[model samples]
Target chain A: MTALTDDTLPVTSRGMRDEMIVFVVMALLLASVPFTGVYPFFVMQALCFALLACAFNLLIGYGGLLSFGHAMFLGTAGYCSAHALKVWALPPELGILVGIAAAFVLSIITGYISIRRQGIYFSMITLALSQLLYFIYLQAPFTHGEDGIQGIPQGRMFGVLDLTKPTVLYYVVLVGFLAGFLLIFRIINSPFGEVLKSIRENEQRAISLGYRTDQYKFLAFVLSGTLAGFAGSLKVFVAQNASLTDVHWSMSGEVVLMTLVGGLGTIFGPVVGAFVIIAMQQYLASFGQWVTVIQGSIFVICVLTFRRGVIGEIAHYFRRSL
Target chain B: MQALYAQLLVGLINGSFYALLSLGLAVIFGMLNIINFAHGALYMMGAFVAYFLLNLGGINYWWALLLAPIIVGIFGMILERTMLQWLTGLDHLYGLLLTFGIALIVQGVFQNYFGSSGLPYAIPDQLKGGMNLGFMFLPIYRGWVVVFSLVVCLATWFLIEKTRLGAYLRAATENPTLVRAFGINVPRMITLTYGLGVGLAALAGVLSAPINQVRPLMGADLIIVVFAVVVIGGMGSIMGSIITGFALGVIEGLTKYFYPEASNTVVFVLMVLVLLVKPTGLTGRAA
Candidate 1:
């Protein structure tokens, strides 16, 4: 049972030091990728999903709440930001803020409803709520039905940095990703994070210890949702559209696959997982439906055999958390 | 009035599916403690199996109805033996993740071969067309679907609640170790329970093929709604699941008549309301 509860796995100072070193090296490498021949847009897209996966990890990994419908946050933020940029003509930063705000409020309502149930029912509730939103977006006039909010302006940031430049957009996305990553890292190290882990390990014990476990779980849910929205808002500028695909259940599944393959509870696992999966999709684009088949195979393999994931496995081998 | 009656009929038909699928989920959850995320994929496979039997093997609907479930159930049993067996004694969430993976694989393979356009399954000659009623034209096939599904649901409820085998199953669910100590092969029973649950999903797929085209992704979305149904019904009481399934369907139908925009969302809204009122679900035992 403890083995299954990966979220509550103890964190060590040595593991934190190693994780920081890996983060710095990875950041420097990502920053220099533009200088190389690798496509910056692809990396930007992957960064967005990486951040999304990380936010998802914050809940499932640290909070032990597997939300099956995370795409609602991403999609909500994307739509809000896209609408702000396209309809209200707001600047990019403000648009992103609007998106985050929307996601924050949505999460509050959804978290209130969802936290009432535990385990599988919690997952189902999140999924149902997201599906309900999906239908609304599908029919709502503001979303333009199937066409979505397309050709959204990348718009200058703070009326200074011209985001139309590929490198500029890439760096903006990277900054957003890094900020989100550090926030999650900080959150998990805080006393609040400890309370969350306690609840995850045993809610009954936590409640007995006089901890308001539901409040902690709800806050974690909101934080995860807000961060996921931030990632989604960043993505709209890169993808230049907010569409149905973002809100689809498959998108939710894709994020889960990303988190699972990277290692559910590890800090760096989701980033690696996101990169691996996004890269696979990029290279396998020509393979058509085989991409799904391959992704599915990876899922089956990971669940059955490689539950620790790539970074998690490496971390285990090194006897340190990644 | 005619439109209302027609919508109600549609609701009843959809309710039958809700009842059938959710009932399968409850049974599987009761025994295996796995959510069976692949249940939808299994349902899709059931439809596809029927499709293949008709097109490739020249089998009739009646034969496909009986055979598809058995074949798919056997396939499910094999899956239980091979993969799902390993997941026992772990957190129930692992079972969910594993099954979700299996679902993606199953749906993806079908999509690769069948495409998403959907293949038509002809209604058997004996069940084709409709009967004219006073207010609205009642499709005989639709009526047959409701009635037949009701029978299946009741029969399943009876088997689980009233039979000797069912007592063993309930006993195992309460205490597998104790049941094993009593000389029953609990592992094999678990596999058979999974098979029976999968078979029920297949049965629903076979029934739905003629009404809804046999498509690869058909069950993909439908399964989510069934999950909501399970949440509302509280996966604890078998009869509660059936009654709630049908009630929600009719409510959805009435919503379609009153506010079409809300028809798809009404069930989920109801689920939220139910969760707020009774977090363990209508009849579910406390976790």
Candidate 2:
């Protein structure tokens, strides 16, 4: 019985020490970016998306739940944060807190409705629920319909470290991304993470093992949503606006694309994927709608030929878990 | 009362399209096990194809209806043989992703050429004008659309439910390997089934061209609602999709008359309620 479980469930491939070394190297490279003269704005935007993608990966990669409406969390948090800062005249940290709270509530409601179904049905349900929110936001007065909430104040954190300074803001965003990333990493290696992985690998077996699988999945959903919301709150500082674009189905698709291109279940894959996609969008902005076509083509190529993704292929060849 | 009747009629017309589209989805899902995310794009393509035939080829409405589905159906078959078929035996999510990519490509190409604005397709000479049903004035084209879509939907239902060919299709769905053991061409049937389903979506597109106008992203948001309908009604039964589609459309129309503000969201709210009550959907068996 133990052999069956061992063979069926993925073996913890690489040593924790190896992962730690890679994490340290990654953190060092990212921390030194302000001194390297690379564009801080682009990195900041990518970091927000990377955090969002990592939060998304925690559910799909480890928990085996694919939410097609994660944009709801991201968009909800961004809108709330923008409102808090701009309209309510709250500080940056409080704005982020309000956003996180909104996302927390939204996740509970959406998760309750969506988690009842499994597989494709779950995805469709989440999508429908998000679209419902989209319509509400479009009509609701506070969202300002298509105009969105704009010109949010990038105030100081803790009454110091002015967010108006590019270098300071970049580090803050980087720190936020790292905090979210480490939290996700910790969750994945925990005993709870193993149980979540077992559920993903085989839900029936997990149930047979007497685990209340639904509660675990629900908890995972809330954690992922709240973290994604945190990324959204951070993004408001960078983008300075919360718009309908964040809530659109296409945004949800972009998150999926990022996670897939990096490595669906891999740790570093989402970060790499987010940077690659954001950079492509920035450079290929001149192509107009052709960019969409290209992104779509990338999706097709990934699903068909490059199913392992960029990081997945690298890890597979190196025979080390990234 | 007259306004209510008119809205109800409008709702039924919308219901007809929903029924046709969701019916097609159910058929495709049964055979392919993939939710065709590109269904909406192909539906939009059908309208575009009709427009092209009328403007360039000088084919009228009736002929365009017959030709568009066949042409787009052929394209869907090519997609199946080329890209989608390669994903056999993989996770269902890959199919959803691949089709989503196809949707974006098709919609993006159309957006590039046509821009984001709507192109008006005039109603054919025969479909113009209206009739007095004693209660309300009914547009002749709208009336024709309802009657024709009902006929097409039921005909599809008959084709799938009460035919020898459908039996083979159902058998294959149940056990493709066992059906293959009997020497039937199961793969060809799968392709044809996809073609048939896509053809149904194109047919709905053709029917709605005059009413909704031809637009690149017309089907984008609409497909999400249909997915909700599928989730609520379940893809297990063909008749279930038909009834649920029409029922939701009618309910939405009633909401439009009763509370205009909530009109856009009534279906989704209902979907959440249904999911809460029955996780397996109204007609779905446990998967």
Candidate 3:
């Protein structure tokens, strides 16, 4: 999860301008994609994972925290939102909110305990907590054990826009992804984000500089978890089910893979990585177990050879943060 | 009371696997500074190797137990030479990611060939009976597993805590450069340590083959619990890992008897409690 060497470089106004231009262009391109005859559901699914990866990137890239159990947030949010829509019959927006709220609460609890330890221990703590939750969900009556919460209605957005239409759902997902992306962007540029970066670079130095580094890390973790939950909730609308796969550790690993492949620290890396991975999975679905093998090889390749990732490598070549 | 005894036996069996796996993790972490995420995959590989030996080569359980570990340990050594060696001096997280990838590859390959349905490994002829102590009947294999693993754990502890080779290992862990200056091949030691650790995981797999059906994903879920165990024990002390492993197993077994629904989650809940009370873990050095 190494950032590009250029990540340490000071951000200039010109660099910010260039980044803004790229972000807008990318957003516009994605917005125009529905007209291009590509499968809207596929893009929507990719967008959800992209948002999840971006949320994950906020912690590992900027805050130097590697959370191995991020699937818990996604799974928790998906299950909550699905339950809200199906059982409570809440509107789509409120259902999403319920999901995000569950993630928020979970993040606070997990983040509080996890921040006590650093490095590998933190990852293990998150993983174990998620696994604990996984077992709980596996037996919980609400989750239906092996069956999961299924056939969730894509309820109206704000009681107006019909989500049953593929195009409308796609646009809604896109908007959610963009808003989440912009929020992460703003957070990284904020003073709080700077403190997180400092802690990441050197925690002892940040502590000596009078920053309660743990608080910064904890806050970043919570934000990441919340956004990931938002993505998970969005995904439930498109996928129409909340299953055990969302909470599985492999799902967490997939998000990490996305972040790593796209560029751990780069702003746009995870989106690209998410699309790349999701598309690979989509097309290679018939390959069965080879997909896992391929994903594993990519992980080995990314770590051993190209630690900078796709966008990180590009940013390094251009000498600018992406 | 009989039910309690049965549950305790189950817990002891599970604890044997935890202790064996966590002990390997501690040994690897001590020398390599890597958590050895592939340890589980290697454990699964150990079981598969035993399966292959018996099915393909007409080998017996006893011989497979001895051979599988050696074979898997050699494979681990090769992995160290090829992939893991390059990751030295990098962040410990990289090692984790790399090993995670390796695990996926190993598990995926096994799944492709074997399918998810588990293959059976029969109990050896010598271990095919039970002893009845009036309260409950104890499967001899289960009892042997607990006793044998404890002996293995203690032997490993003694080797690391008392042997001169262990002294070199501890010295390397502290200051690799200083030890290198003193003419010890620390790199070779690191590689061998990884092999030894992988071998221990394999040994656990071989032991577990008859009880737990040999499946591709066998080690996948089991490793997570072992990670929880490692966290509670704090990867600092060998004895701490062993004691914690056995103790947590019994606790989980008791939980199974009283509250069967929570059997899967008891270890993790215990980890949370341990973390809340002792952030550095029970015996871990302050990081």
Cα displacement (angstroms), candidate 2, residue A294, comes to: 0.7
Question: Lowest summed-lDDT stretch of 10 residues in model 3 chain A?
Answer: A1-10
Candidate 2, B1-287: lDDT as tens digits: 99898888888888988898999999998999889999999999999999999999999999988999999999999999999888777777788989999999999999999998889999999989999989899999999998998899888888889999999999999999999999999999999999999998998899999999999998898899999999989999988988998899899999999998998999999999999899899999975
Span of ten consecutive residues with least summed lDDT in model 2 chain A: A1-10
lDDT for A182 (candidate 1): 96
Q: Give all candidates' CA lDDT scores.
A: 0.92, 0.91, 0.93
TM-score of each: 0.98, 0.98, 0.98
Of models 1 and 2, which has the larger DockQ?
1
Q: Which residue pairs show backbone clashes in model 2?
A: none
Error of 1 at A51 (Å): 0.7
The CAPRI quality class of candidate 3 comes to: medium
lDDT of 3 by residue, B1-287 (tens): 99999999999999999999999999999888889889899999999999999999999999998999999999999999999999877777888999999999999999999999999999999999999988899999999999999999999999899999999998998899999999999999999999999999999999999999999999999999999999999989999999999999999999999999999999999999998999999999886
- TM-score, candidate 3, is 0.98
Give the winner by DockQ: 1 or 3: 1
lDDT of 3: 0.93
| Model 1 ranges off by over 4 Å | A1-3, A6-15
lDDT of 1 by residue, B183-248 (tens): 999999999999999999999999999999999899999999999999988888889989988998
The residue-by-residue lDDT of candidate 2 on A1-322, one tens digit each, is: 1211122123357677777898999999999999999999999999999999999999988888888999999999999999999999999989999999999999998888888998889888989998999999999999999999988889999899899999999999989999999999999999999899889878999999999999999999999999999999999999999999999999999999999899888888999999999999999999999999999999999988887678878877777777
